[model samples]
Target: MHEFTPPSGTLLGVGLGPGDPALITLKAADAVARTRVLAVPVKARGAESFARRIVAGRITPAHTVLELVFPMRSDPEVLRPHWQRAAQAILTHLDRGEDVAFLCEGDPFTFGTFIYVFREVARLRPHAPVEVIPGVSAYHAAACRTLTPLAAGDDRLCVLPATYGVEVVETMLERFDTVVLLKVKPVMDALLDMLARTGLTGHAVFVNKVGTDEEAVVTDVASLRGRKLDYLSLMLVRNPARVKEPVLRGCRPKVGA
Candidate 1:
């Protein structure tokens, strides 16, 4: 057996992947296996750990799961207080020399709540080591779930939160080579309406709970007219022929050989 090193003082913002625990990257899995404390969100008296559920099968009682309560509202009045509390909890762990693996649902740097702690801890203790482990983002999982290639040779890829309304989506359809609409709960209906009218509906796919038992992939946007959806879902629409740069376009010299 190898010597077990004492926990070094560091913070690892680990990504748990989209939904399936099996999809977690090898590096992320190693981080989880080594995490001393796993911080999770606890809302109200009985809210689910939507993020942790992504890795439920992999976690064990041996791994400490710390719940950091977060308010369900984004009201300016309540937001700061919740963030402060979350930061305090993580800082407490750091002070103990136990590295914290703050698990996030997707890429740690991409919309992960771990930033709140990252900023606060760095501000207070400038020399703390912080490392981010990348995982399979929702868009990548969704695209794979639907078997849709995001980009081709020289094809562009743009991922945007679905908080934008129909108008913004229409604008994206106009300019981008491909679009992955995330956090798509609120505007599913309106966006579907826009895609239908714009004739882009056929190329779009609605993906939910990818890589899990509840995973779903729908080709018809209108089919989801009034259905309930998990917030972890995404919509992928691609048009690969937009800017096909010929690999051999510049193969020959400008002047004849």
Candidate 2:
């Protein structure tokens, strides 16, 4: 091992985008390449890492890679300390003037755990240079993989977490012409119920593990109830008003014009 002293350095949180290797941004690739140390988070003992799998073909063994074990379950007491320690580990590398890159799946800011590092690093060492490279979010990837569109014509689309309560989801369904729910692993039932209540269930589509080998898409959300899922998945509900026939009928009906 080697010794170290405090030095100015950059901490790059690079998003690998969705599972498709080609989707990774070129700039993100450069960040990974230049980093003297790469920090990849680990779940439990001997578990396959989703982030690592996304960038497996690009990383080299010569670079220093650190695994910070983060508990998958959300326990208020357990999470903060783990994340705090993880930030310290990363900061240690950065303190040595070594550029450290944290590999993230999809966009680092959207429903991402990297923000834990971002917050702590900001709190503990505010001067550290931080760079966040945008990557393909599961939002567009899920829609594209399922051959669906986020919106059509003048229709407005909203993207939100499916974990929202039934009341909020019901409001969103009525407000937006197209709704995309991200990180849908926990509240599948609530989402399905909202769709069913709105009578849009028949047209809803569920896409799981987008861009990865395990990817699966189902046009019927009704069949998806009570099943296992991935946090990386998303669903799209086609709006009737977004179709050609319906929109052509609405232009003359919206009021005096």
Best-fitting candidate, scored by lDDT: 2
lDDT of 2 by residue, 150-195 (tens): 7766677888876666677667767777788876788888778777
Over 4 Å off, model 2: 1-6, 75-77, 152-154, 241-257
lDDT tens digits, residues 196-256, model 1?
7877888888988787788888887789878888777889977543445455666657876
C-alpha lDDT of candidate 2 relative to the true structure: 0.81
The residue pairs found clashing in candidate 1 are: none
Each prediction's number of clashing residue pairs: 0, 0
Q: CA shift at 166, candidate 1, in angstroms? A: 2.5
